[model samples]
Target chain A: MNPTLDKLLGGKQGAIGLAVLAALILVVFPLLLDAFRLNMVGKYLTYAFVAVGLVLCWGYGGILSLGQGIFFGLGGYCMAMFLKLEASDPESTKIQSTPGIPDFMDWNQITELPMLWQPFHSFGFTLLAVIAVPVLLALVIGLTMFKRRVGDVYFSIVTQAIALILTVLIIGQQGYTGGVNGITDLKTLMGWDIRTDEAKLILYFVSAFLLFGCILLARFIIASKLGRLLLAMRDKEERVRFSGYDVASFKIFVFCVGAAFSAIGGAMFTLQVGFMSPSFVGIVPSIEMVIFAAVGGRLSLLGAVYGALLVNFGKTYFSESFPELWLYLMGGLFIAVVMYFPNGLAGLWDSHGKRWLTRIKPKANAPVKTEPVAKPVAKAAPTPELETTP
Target chain B: MEWLSEFGAIAAMQGFNGLSVFCVLLLMALGLAIIFGQMGVINMAHGEFLTIGAYTTFVVSSLTEQYAPAFGPYYFFFAIVLSFLIAGAIGWLVEWAMISKLYQRPLDTLLATWGLSLVMQQTFRSIFGAREVSATLPEWLMGSWNPTETIDIPRNGLFVMGLTILLTAIIFLMLYRSRWGLQVRATMQNRVMSRAVGINTKRVDRMTFALGCGVAGVAGAAFTTIGSTGPTAGSLYIVDTFLVVVFGGAASLFGTIASAFSIAQAQSIMEFFMSGSMAKVLTLSAVILILMMRPQGLFSIKVRK
Candidate 1:
C-alpha cells in the first residue's frame, strides 16, 4: 500500500472496527429485544433520518434550520391522512358522526371528506405526497430565502416562524386536519396489519434499512463535488460566488434534499407509531431537532445519527423513569453540552484518534510528513485539471 | 343609526380588550426586547418564566386564602412582587448556568433555552397536574366599568393597562436614565470597550436577563386575571410574544410598545370580524409579509457593521 493510504487506513481501523461492531449489535439486538424495545429503536432510527438532514443543512451548508419538525410533521400527517381515509368505513355515509373523524372534526360537524383528502385513499399517492409536500414547501421557501441572501440568525428565525405558522395552521384547520387531536387509531399500512408483532418487526427492519441507506447517501453526497461546493459556500460564500458558483442554487438544493430526507423520516415515523399530530411539527420539536444535531456533532454525519439516537433514548428513558425531573435533566444536558463540548462528541473522538495514532506510529508519521510533499502535490493537481478539461 | 351605534359599541369593547391584550403583550415583549435587543440572545424560556410567575401568584393567592382572608384583595400585590422575585431568581440562575456560556452563540442559546422551557413546562405539569388553575379575582376586578350604556370594559383589563403604562415608564427610566442602564447600553454596543471601561459585563448580562424575566413574570401575574393558568398556557403566549418582539425590532423598547399596540389592535379587530384562529393566521401572515419587506423590523436601529 502507498504510505499515505497506509497511514489513513491505519488510524481509522479501530474506529471503523468499532462502528462495524456497533452495526452488528444494532441488527442482532432487535431480534433478542422485546417488541417494545425494538419499536423504540425503530423510532430512534426514524429520528436519525431527520438528524442526517439537519447535519447536511446545518453542519455542511451553514444553515441552522430549526424547522425540520415541520417537514417531518408534514410527511407524517400526509401518511396518516391516507391511513385514516383507507381505514374509514365507506358504508358509513355519516363520516362526521363517526368518532374516527377525530374529536375536533366531530365537534366541527364536517359531514363530508374534503376534496383534498380524496387522493390519500391510495397508498401510492399517500407515499408520494409524504415526500412531495415537504420538499415542495422547502423548495419554495428555500428559493425565496436563499435568493434574498437570508442567512445566519435571520434564516434560523424565518424557519422557526415557518414551523410555528405551520403548526398553528394545522391546528386551526380542525375540520379536515384533525386539529389538536391529530390523526390516530391507525390500524394498517398498505394492507399489512400494523398492530401485529411480526409487522412491528418488519417495520423495525425497514426503519433500520432506511437509516443505513440515508447514512450511505449522506456519506456519498459529502464525498461528491456538490458537497464540496456546499462546504465552500458555508465557509466563504462571497469567495464561492466570485468563483462563479450560484450560491443560492447550492443552498436551495441542499435545503430541499434535507427537507426530503426529513419527510422520509416522518413517513417512516408515522408508519411505525400509527399516529401523527400538529404537536410533532411545532416550534418546540423543531428546536429539539437542532439540539440533537448540535449535541451529536453537527460536523459528522455519523455524529448526527449517534446524537439523535442518544438524545432520543435519553428522552424516552428519562421521561419513563423520572417523568417530573426529565425536563430538568434535559435542560442540564443541553447546558452541559453547550458550555463544555462546543465541538461535540465526534470532535473528542477525532482528537483522541489522532493522539493514539501519533503515540503508536510517531517515527513512521514523522518521516512521512517531513519527506513526502513533492510526488503527491504533483499528482493531485493534474487529476483536477484533467476533470475540468473533460 | 341604531345599527351604527351597536357597531360603535362593539368596536369600543374590542378597543378596550385590545388595549388590555396589548398591555400583556408589550410587557412580555419588553423583556424579550431587552434580552434580544441588548444581548442578542433569543431567550425561548421567556414564556416559561411568565408561567413561573403565574404559578407563584397561584401559590401566593392560595397562601392568602388560607392564612389571611381579611387581607383579601391585597394578596394580589404581594403575589405580584413574589412572582417577580421568583421568576427573576430563575432567570438569574439560567443566565449564570446556561445562557452566560452561550453569549457569542445566540442560536445555541435559543436551543438551550427551548430545552429549559420544556423542562420548566414538564416540571410544572408534574407539579400542577396538567389542568387549568382557576385564580380567584377580587370583587373589584370582577365587574366591568360602564363608559356608556352599551359599552362596558372589564375593570381588570383597565387595571392591566394602567400597570403596563406604569411598568413601561419605570423600565424606560431605568434603561435610559440609570447608571446601570448606561453600563448595559455600553455593553450591548461594544462588549470589549465596555469591559475596558471597567464595567462588569457579566453582571450586566445577569441583571438584564433577570430584569427581563421579572417583566415576563409581571405579565404572567397580569395574565392570571384574564386567562386560565396551566402548565401549557405558556406555549400559547410564546408565538404572540415573539411576534411582538420581532415586529417591534429586538432591541427597540419604543418599537416593542408600538408593535404591541398595533398587532394587538389588528388581532382584536380581526377576531371581531373573523374566527379567533383565522384572525391569528391573518395577523401572522401580515407580519410575515411585513418582515419580508423590512427584515430589521419597524423602527430598527442601524448598528455598526
Candidate 2:
C-alpha cells in the first residue's frame, strides 16, 4: 500500500517473488537439508552474489566481464589471510622454522612475513581490504578499457586474460599465495572455531541475510533513473554519449558495483568453505559464474540466484555420480541456453508458465487479463520494475 | 676465448629455441587472425580444432605403425594434409550448425564456442584416454643439426620451422594473390555491400572459417614435434594465440606474424632467466599493459566504424 515500500520491493509482483525466495532460502532450505547440504547451499549462495552482479553488469549494463572470479578470489584471499594469520600464532606454530608466518611461507624457506601479509593481521583492515582490493582493481580495469572505448568482445577477452594472469601469478608465487594448494587448514575466525556444525549453521543464515540485502540493493538501483541509463547504454552507446551523459562513468560505476558484490561473495565463501584457490580464480570458474547468471535468466536478479543453485546442484550431483557425463551435460547446457533459451527460466515462465497458472485458476484470471498487454513491454525492455513472477 | 665461444653457442641455441617458438605461435595466430580479425567471429573452440589436428596425427601415426610400417617416414606428410582436411570439414560443419546463427551476437558465439570446446575436449578424453600422447617421429626427424658444440638444434625443430614458413607463405599468397582473397577481403570490409555486388558472402564466411580452422590443424601437427598432445593441450595456448592475434592487430596477417615472433621471443628469453611461470606472468602483464594503452593493438589499420 505504501508507495516507497512498494517501489523498494519492485511493486506487488516483485514483493511476492522476494517473499517466496526468502521463504525458500531461509526457511525451507534450513528445515529440509542437513548441515552439510545447507553449507553447500550457502556456498552456492555466495556464487549467487556474483550471479546477481552479472545480472546488473552483463544483463542490464551489457558489459560482460569474464573475470568476476578475480574479485571473488581477492575477497576470499583477504578473509583467508586474516584467518590464516590468527591460526599461525606463535603458540601453534612453534615447531616451524618461522613461528608466526603462514606454514606455506615457512615451507618455502621465507623467515619473515612479507610486507603484503602484515596488514592482514588486523581483522578490520582485512574486512576493508576484501571489498577495497577488488574495487580498486575493477577501477583500474574499468578506467583503462572503458575510457579508451574498448568494449564488447575485446573487453571480455581482456578480462579473461586478466583472470588467466591472476591464476598463473597466484600459482607461480606459491610461497606467497600458498601456491596451487591454496590457503588451507584455516581453523578459526577471530577466535570463533568455524569448523563446528553450529558455526556452519549460523554462517549459513548470515550469508542468507547478506544475500537478501544485496538483492534489495540491486533492486533499488534497478528502480532508479540510473538504471534506465544503463539500459539505454547497453542498447545504443553512441546515442547515450551524444546526449551528454558521460556513458563511460556509468559503465565504470556498474562494473565496480559488480566487482564489489563478487568480492563480498568471495569473502563469505572463504568463511564458509575455509579456503580459497586459483581453481576458483581462473577463466573456467569465471565463465562458469557467467553461466549461472545466464541459466537464471540474466535479466532477473532473483532468477540468477535460482540459476546458481540449480547449476551447482547439477554439477555436484552429476560429478559425484557420473563424472564422465558432467562435462558433456554442462557443455550441452551452455550451448542449449545460448541457442534456444537466451532468456532462461524466467523468460520461460513469463511466456508459458504464467499463462498455465492463470488458466488453472480462473478466479485469478481477471487480474491476469490486463497483464498480457503489459507483458510484451516487460519481456522486451526488461526494466526490473516490470518483472513478474508466480 | 673458449668461454666467449661457449657463451655465443648458448645464446645461439636459445635464439634458435625462440625461433622454434615463434614459428608455432605464428601458425596458431594466423588461423585466429583470419577468424577473429577477418570474420569478427570469436571462436573459443579454435584450440579444440588444434587438438583435432593433433589427435588426427596421433591416429594416423598409430595406423601407419600398425599396418603400413613401410610407410612410416612418409606418412607424416599425408597426415598433415589429412589434418587440414578433417579439421576444415569439421569447421565447415560447425559454421553451418552453430556459428552462422550467432554472427550478430559475438558474445553468445564466444559462449557457444566454449561449449563446443568442452564437448570436443570430452570427446578427446573419451577416445584417447586422459593421458598425453605423441606421434612417433621418423629417424630422420630425430637427432640434431649441430652448428657448434653447445648449439645443437633438434632436426624436428628445423622441420617444424620449415613447415611453418611454407604454410605462412601459402596463406599469405592465398590471401593476397588469389581471387578468393579478394572476395574474402571484400566480404570482411563490407558484407552487405559485397553481397549486393553478387559475392556469395555466406559461402565466403563458411570457407574463411574453415580455412582458419584448417590452419589451426596444421599448427597442431607442428605442435606434436615440440610437445605432447593432450585433450586440453590446445586450450593452454588459446590465450597466448589470442594475444598474438590481438597484438598483431587482428586484421593484418603480417601483424600476426610480427606479434607472434616478438611475443615468443620475449617469453622464451625471459624464461631463460627466470622461472618459466614468472616469465609467462611478466610477458603477459607487459602485453596487457600495452593492450590497455593501445586498445586497437600494435598494427591496426585506420577504418571508420
Candidate 3:
C-alpha cells in the first residue's frame, strides 16, 4: 500500500500538493472566472504542457530544446489541416475556380488541393500524424545531434534555427499554408459546433483532464529509477556513462517524449483557440515557452502550470491596460526568475512555504520521517524535488 | 555582347552586396565570439549593444543636421567613437551588477542577457518610438563608385568594408600582442594560476567584456549605412550572430570570419534567385546539417572540461 502510494505520489506531501492543484484547476478556476477568462486560462494551460515537457527534458535529462514550438506547431498545423479540409467542402467553396480546396488556396489561385493536405482528410490519420510527425522529427534531430555529441548551447541554437525555418516556410507558402495569417476560420470538430459556450466549457474540462493525466505520467517518469539516472546524467555525464548506461538513448527517448508532450498541447490549443498560426511556431513564442518553464520552476511540472497561468494572466492584464509596460514586466520577470529564483515558484515554496506549512499543520510532520533522505546538494537540492512536480 | 554586359553588371552588384553583408556579420560575430568563445558568457544582449551604437549614430546625425550643419561630413567618425565609448561604459556596469555573479552558470547568462535584451529593446521603443529611423550619410559616403561602366560599388559599402578590415586587425593585435590581452587570455585559460601570478583577473574580465561590446557598437555604426534601425532591428540579427559565432568554432577569430563570409554570401546570392523565406530555409537547413556532421564546429577549440 505504501509503495504504490509512494510510486504514484512520491510521498504524502506530493499527494496533498497534487490534490490541491487538481482542486484549483478543476474547481476554483471554473467557479471564479467568466467564460472569457476561463478560455484564456485554457490557452495558458496549453503552454503548461510544453513547460511540463521542458521540466522532463531540461531539468532532468539535461537537454535544453529551444525549438519546442516546432513540435507544437507541427501538431497544431496537422489538426488545422484536417479541420480546414472538413470546412472547405466542395459545397462551401463552389464560388471559387476550384470547388474542393480551402478558401485561401482558391484566393491564391490554386486550382486543386495539394497532395500534402490530402492525408489530413481522415481524422484518424490526422490524429496519428500529430503525434508521429513531431516524434519522428525530434527523433531524427536527437539521434543526429546527440550521437555526434553536440554541446548544450549548440543544440539550443540548432533547435531555434529549425523553429525559424518552419515559421518562414509556413509564412512564405501563402497558397499552401494560408501564409503568415496562419490557418483560421475553424468551425466544427467531427460535425459538432465547437463555437458554442457550452462546447468551450466542455473543451476546457477536457483540456484540464488531459493536462492532469500528463502530470501523472510525468510524475511517474520522475519517480522511476530512470528519472534518477537522468538527474545523475545532468550532474555528471561521464560518471553516469562510466556506470554502464547508454546515455545517448535515454536522451533521445526523453526528447521524443518531450516532443509528444508539446504536440498534445498544440492540438488542445487548436481546439480551444480555433486557429493555428506561424506566430506560435517562431523563435519569440518558443523562447516564451521556455520562460513559462523557468517561471514555473524548471524542476517542477506542477509549478510550470501555475507559472504559465500567472505569467499569461499578467501579460493579458498589463497589455490590455498599458501595452508598452507589459514588455518591461515580462523582461523583469525573466531577469528576476533567472537571477534570484532559478527554481521558480516551486523552489520558493520549498524554501519558505514549507516552514509556514510546518507551523500551520503539525500533522503534516507525520510523513517527514517516512520521506526519503537527500543525496547532498550538488547545485540542486537533495530532497523534496517530488514536491515541485504534481 | 550587350546581354553579357548586363549579366556581368548583375553579378558585380550582387558580389558587392554580399561583401557588405559579410562585413556587418564579421564585425558583429567578432564581438559575440570574444564574449561567448573567450569569456564563456553567452551575452544574448550583444545585439542590443550593437543597436545602441546604431542609435548613437542616429542621434549624432540628427544633432549635426539640426544644430551643427557645417560639421555634417565629419559627424560619422565622432558617432563611431561615441558609440564605442557609451556601449563599453554600459557593458562595464552590466558586468559589475549582473554578469560577474553568473559566470559559473552559463545557461543562466543566456536567460539573464535575453531579459536584458528585451529591456533594452523596450527602452529603445520608448525612447525612439516604434518606427524605424535611418541616419543621414555624409556626402562623401553617399553614392557609388563607377569602376568602369559595367561595375559600380556603393561608396558607403566600400567604406564599411574598409572599417571592418581595420577593426579586425585592431582586435587581432589587442587580443594577441597587448599586455592586457595576455592577462585576459591567461585568466580565461587558468583563472587560479593567473590570479596567483597577480593578473588582476576581475579587472581583466571587465575590460575584455567591455572591449567585445565596444566592437559590437562599432558594428552597429556600420549597420546604419546598410539598413534602417528600429527597436527590434537588433533582435532580428541576434540569433544569426549567435549561429555565426557557433558555426565558426567559438574559440577561433579566423573561423568566425570564414563562417560569416560564407553565410552572408550564400544568403545574399540565393536571395536573388529564390524567395527570401526560401533562401533562409535553405541556408539554415544547410548549416544545421553541417553542424550535425561536425558538432565540434568548423574548427576545434580545446579546453579542459
Candidate 4:
C-alpha cells in the first residue's frame, strides 16, 4: 500500500469502511427505498453532517456543545429566507397587502422587508450566509467561553441556555422570524421547484455527495498534527497550556469547524425538507444531535454517519409503530450508551466486530498484514476512563 | 400626579409578582445548588423531580376531595410534605441505581439524568394524559389581598412566598447547624478524607442528593398554586433554574437567593414593558453575558487545591 493512501484513508480497513458506508447510502439506500423514504434518508444524512463535526469537537476536542442545532437552524433559515423571497415575488404575491414580502410578513402588516432579511434575497449571499452566520455565532461563543476557560458541564449548560434564548427570540419576533412555525412554504430555489419528486432525488444525491466531502474533510483534520494536539488537550488541558500552547485557540477552531459542518447540513435540510422552523433551533434538537455523535462513536467519523442512519431509522420505525415507546426507548438508549457503550457503535465494532473479522479473514485467505486497526485505535481505550475521572 | 400614582400601583403589583417568581426560582435553585454546588453532580432530572412533586400534590388533592371533603383545605399542607418525601425517595433510588455509578463522570451524569428526565416526562404523559392539570386550591388560597384600592395581590402568591421562606430557612439551618451538614461539607471538600474520618460518605452523598430533590418537590407543590402543571412544565423552568444557580455562584447558598431574586425581578419588570418571551430572552442573555465575564459567577469562593 502507498504511504500517502494509507495516511489518507486511515489504512486499508478504514478505506473498506468508507466504501461500504458509501455503497450503503449512495447505492443501496437509493436503490432499495422509494422516493419518499430516500428523501427521509437524505434528511438523516444531513444530520450526519453535524454528527461528523461533533466527532471532532465533542469526541476529540472534548467540547460537548449542546447547541449545534442553533447553527443547523441558522443555515436552514438562511436558505429558507432566499427561497421564501423568491416564492413571494410581486407577481405571485399580488393578493397580499404587501406585494413582494413573505406571507407571514404581510399578515403581520409589515409594508417593507426588515433590514435583517434584505441580504437573504440573493441566492449567492444566502449560500454564503448559511455557513458564515453559524460560524460567526460559534466564533463569538467560542471566544467568550474558551478564552475564559469555561468548559465541561458549565459550557454545556451555557450552550443549552443559548439554544433557549434563540428559540425565544425567534418565537417572540414572529413578524420577522415567522414566529414558532418557522420559515415555511419555501417553494422554489433559483426558479427550480424543490417539492417535486425528481427534485427530491437530485437533492438526495447532492446531500449524499456533500456529506461525503464533509466526512473526508473531517478525516483529513483528524490525520493532521492538530488532531494529536486536540487529543492531548482533551486528556490534559493544563499540561497542554503548560507546554506553551494557546489551548483555547485550538478549541475555538475545532468548534467553528463543527458549526460550519452543521450549517451546511442545515442548508441541505431546507432544500430537501421544504421548510425550517424554530423547533429545530431549540434544546431538544440540539441535544438529539449530540446523541447522534455519541451513538456513532464520537471518535469515529465514519461511525458518526452510521450512527445517524441507525438512530433515525429506529426513531421513524418506533414512533410510527408505538408512539409512547419511542421516548422510553430513546431515553433508554441515552442511558445505555453512556453507561455501557461509552465509545458507541464503532467502539463495539473495535472490540467485538474486529475479532469476528480477523477470524473470517484467515479463512478467506486474506493477508495477516492488515492487523493495524487494533493498534491504531488502542489509544482510545483509556479515554472513556479518563472522561469519567475528570 | 394621578398618573404617577397609577404607575406606582402598577410597579407595586409587578414587584409583588416578581417576588412570587423569586420564591419559585429560589426554591428550585436551592435544590439544584445543593446537588450541583456541594455534590459536583449535574442532575438534569431535577426538573422532573419538581414535576413529580406537582403530580403527587394533584393526587393527594383529588384523594382528599373524594374521601374527606372536610380535609380539603388542609390537604395542601399534607401534600407538600408528601411531595418532598416522595420526590426525595425517588431521588434516593435514582442515586443508587444510576448516579452512584456516575459519581466520577459529571458530564455523563448530565446525559443520563437527561434520559431519566425524558422517561419521567413520558411516564407523566402516560399517567396524566398530557393535558395541563391544576390542583383545586382551598377557598382561602383563592381571591386576593387588597392592600389598597389599586393594589391586589393573589393570596396564593403570599402563600407560596411564605412557604419559600420557611423552606429556605430550614435548608440554611440544616446546612449550617446540623451534623448531616458537616458530613456533606466534608464530603464535598474532601471525599477521601471524609471517608477516612469514619463518615459514611456514600450515605452523605445520597442524603444530600435526596435533600436537593426534596426541595425541588416542595417547589413543585408551591407551583400548583400559581400555575397549571403539564408534563413538560418542569422542563420549561429547568434552564432558568440552572441559570439562577450558576449566576449565584454554584457553591454559595446566599448567592443563589440573591441571583434568583435579581433575575426574577428583572424578568417580571421587563415583562411589564415588553413581550414575555422577549423579557425571558433579555434576562437569559444578560445572565450569559455576565457569566462570560465572571465565569466564577457572582460570588464564587477561591480555594487553594
Supply fnat for every model shown: 0.38, 0.59, 0.70, 0.76
Residue pairs of candidate 4 with colliding backbone atoms: none
What is the Å distance of residue A296 in model 4 from its true position?
A: 1.4
Show where candidate 2 strays beyond 4 Å.
A363-390
What digit string (tens of lDDT, one per residue) describes model 3 on residues B1-305? 99999899999899988988899889889898889878888898999999999999999999999999999999999999999999999999999989998988777788888889899999999999999999999999999999779788889999999999999999889888999878878898999999999889999999889989999999999999888999988888888888888888887888898999999999999999999889988987888888899876787568886
Candidate 3: segments with Cα more than 4 A from true spot:
A362-390
TM-score for candidate 4, residues paired by index: 0.95
Top lDDT model: 2
The sequence of per-residue lDDT tens digits that candidate 1 reaches over residues B1-305 is: 98998999987887888887788888788778888777788888888888988888888877778898888788888888988899899899989988888887776787777777877888898898888895677778889898789998888888888888988998899999999998998899889999998999999999999988988898889888887899878877776777777778767889889999999889898888888887887888788768766777888788883
The CAPRI classification for model 4 reads as high
Q: How much does each candidate deviate at the interface, measured as C-alpha RMSD after superposition?
A: 2.0, 0.6, 1.0, 0.6
**After TM-score superposition, what is the CA distance of residue A161 in candidate 4 from its true location, in Å?**
0.6
Q: What is the C-alpha local distance difference test score of candidate 3?
A: 0.89
Clashes of each: 1, 1, 0, 0
Model 1 TM-score, all chains together: 0.86
The candidate, 2 or 3, that scores higher on DockQ is 2
- What residue pairs are clashing in model 3? none
If the candidates were sorted by their lDDT against the true structure, best first, what order would they fall in? 2, 4, 3, 1
Q: How much is B86 displaced in model 2, in angstroms?
A: 0.6
lDDT of candidate 2 over A193-297, digit per residue (tens): 999999999999998999899999988888888899999999999999999999889999999999999999999999999999999999999999999999999
What is each predicted model's overall lDDT from 0 to 1? 0.81, 0.92, 0.89, 0.91
Q: After superposing candidate 4 on the true structure, give the runs of residues whose Cα lies further than 4 Å from its correct spot.
A: A1-4, A363-390, B1-5
